[model samples]
Target: MTETSTGGKGAPATRRLSAFLYRHDRLRLAGLLTPPILWLVVLYIGSLGVMLVSSLWGVDSFTGSLVKKVSWSNYHTLFTEPVYRTVALRTLGIAISVTLIDLVLALPLAFFISKVVQGRRWRYALLIMVTMPLWASYLVKGYAWRIMFDKGGVIDWMFAPLGLHGPGLGLTATVVALAYLWLPYMVLPIYAGLERLPESLLEASADLGASPLRTLRSVVFPLLVPSVVAGSIFTFSLTLGDYIMVKIVGGTTQMFANIVYDNVGVAGNLPFAAAAAVFPIVVILGYLLAVRRSGALENL
Candidate 1:
């Protein structure tokens, strides 16, 4: 009799709480969003804040100990040093090259998948194949590229008939590897954009006496800019911070990320590494702001 009485009282209390929550829509929304908001603020933004603060601290040159005092010596070195400038420029060039290569390759392929492919099964299978490379480990893909770029490897074997040879391990190989790694990031966005595009627009262009090439240039290209910008954000930012792919295939080519890795791991200078890390963050922020100003981010 006592257990039955307690259980009967608990049921009414649970009903009251659920009824209260259902009555207050704003409160319910806040309850749903609070966990993820807290997670983002504490983990992502908090780590970035810590890194920015650490970048201001100084390092002792002689003893290799942290100086604890704040200073701008690290940023000053990055600006004044010619080698740092060279590495920064090289990193930017590689990133831009990779973005352009992926853009060219993805445009035709994404169009085919979105517009020209006849059946649903064929389209899905091709999309899966485009993304299949991502299922493998990152290092595995890097080393695989290294092997193919090696002397007498698959690349050389393929080119032997044409009396040419592989570019071997260097900037050429690094760019090619980075391009292959990030191609899917570029493809999916463009494919989705193309899928959302109205076929009637293309029909109108054709009925108006526009050729397919002209229709693509005038009608399709303008509508796809936002997706292209979205895709470039992934490709460009990823290539900027990548160190491992360059390490495996870059040979003596030192990128901006390599400088940061060396400072922290090899030189034992955490302050300098944090400062070096700020460059890409700033660059990406600028790119995002520019995209926003152009109204492309709204569509995305």
Candidate 2:
């Protein structure tokens, strides 16, 4: 039988490429990373830089046009205005509330799903149930919640027997909607972290005569801190930037995002909006810094 040359020139080509990559490590790394680096620099960082610069610039009230001249007036207004302060604080409060609510709800459910649940199929089913909401449209979810919060709606109907009523389109409704929207984000991370936890350690803790609560406090929670922080980063930042849900369910309550939108669209003041937009970014950065300080990010 005649021997056929398998792989033809593929082997030599692959070997040559491997040799070149090995010889030029920096070049290979740059080649691998250049696309993402370019995207970050050109899109994300560039947009942020533009926002910062525009926030510093002023609008010509006489001509009703943007002035290229740099000024601190917009930021000064953001600082000095009472409405701005109130809205900023309110938005911060709502974000914090959403994060806390999601965390409280996610922890136990994640533990149940990751540790207590038996069989792979059941575990996957629970995870799917947890994540299924995310497949729905964002606007659809918001509007659905809006309907539920409306007068004589599902929430009102449910609470009517208790001689109470739903928190009609307001801060509470907004927080509830946000928590519902972001809960999956919080759950998945904690579930993953919990699943990754060593069963042997848990066994050891029980063997060492630690109660369930004590074991969780002294072992599980400490290891889960990084995942919790990671999840909160998403929930907090998403809540901070969200304006649509608030618009739908928040009624007259204006979040920082709502204020920014009003300034940009109603007031026709992009510079002022840009300046106001810096607050959430600053707040999120501060949170990330706090998380880092606690060494959770290092674990991540």
Candidate 3:
């Protein structure tokens, strides 16, 4: 061994730092994770608990503060008021529709990217193309759709050559915008699942007498269930809470979250806003539970 190889003490600095970290500063390592943990407990969970408790609290006329009060009236109002039920259902329905449409599209796209595209660079390029839209702002995407859908805008002008002037844009355009915005969230997860699939299974299926369609159904689809579930959750949860898209495109048709946001910002009703805020989580959890109860949960 060469004594000069140590280079006059670069090694000792690293060793000393490592020894110091090991000897007396577990607290530093612990402190690194504490902020996110604290944020999860204090902000995420604490807010949910506050919302649940506040939803139970009745609105006081004089005090203008919701203090300790508990009753089922708010939830009852949610059910009895046809408008509330309709808005809530519309949000749920949109989420479900978007999720279904996303899966239908994403499955083929993901599978094609994973299996058909031969070159590594091209595969990555295609994936990045699909994913690049995700980096764009949600508000920007909504507004982009709005720009396209407006009369004399790109879509109307392009279709005018065929003498096809579409319905003047609003709710339908919003759904298209929202769907485009959330599609990548579904695609990425499913692509990850498909990309991780073992090539040997496909070989074995081919060795046996299964066609490509049968192999996918019998082998690939079952293995991809976790990704499917995860993608659905992403699309459903994101669509359920969308405000900018609904406000920009639908204009008058109120989504459940948009309604709550408007009540908080515009109408100045904190208690009712809290009640409405509770609605989306309940819908998300209900779907999650139902999906879990189904055989799809085996993926998890």
- Give the TM-score of each candidate: 0.92, 0.93, 0.86
TM-score of 2: 0.93
User: What lDDT tens digits, residue by residue, belong to model 1 across residues 262-282?
Assistant: 998999999899999999999
lDDT of 2 by residue, 10-99 (tens): 677889999999999999999999999999999999999999999998888888688888999998998998988898899999999999
lDDT (tens digit, per residue) of candidate 3 on 186-268: 99999999888988999899899999999999999999998998998899898888887888878677888877787678866
Question: Judged by lDDT, which candidate is best?
Answer: 1
Better of 1 and 2 by TM-score: 2
Better of 2 and 3 by lDDT: 2
Candidate with best TM-score:
2
Task: Write the number of the candidate with greater lDDT, choosing between 1 and 2.
Answer: 1
Off by over 4 Å in 3: 1-33, 157-165
RMSD of each: 3.0, 2.2, 3.6
Clashing residue pairs in candidate 2, if any? none
Candidate 1 segments exceeding 4 Å error: 1-18, 295-300
A best-first ranking of the candidates according to their lDDT comes to 1, 2, 3
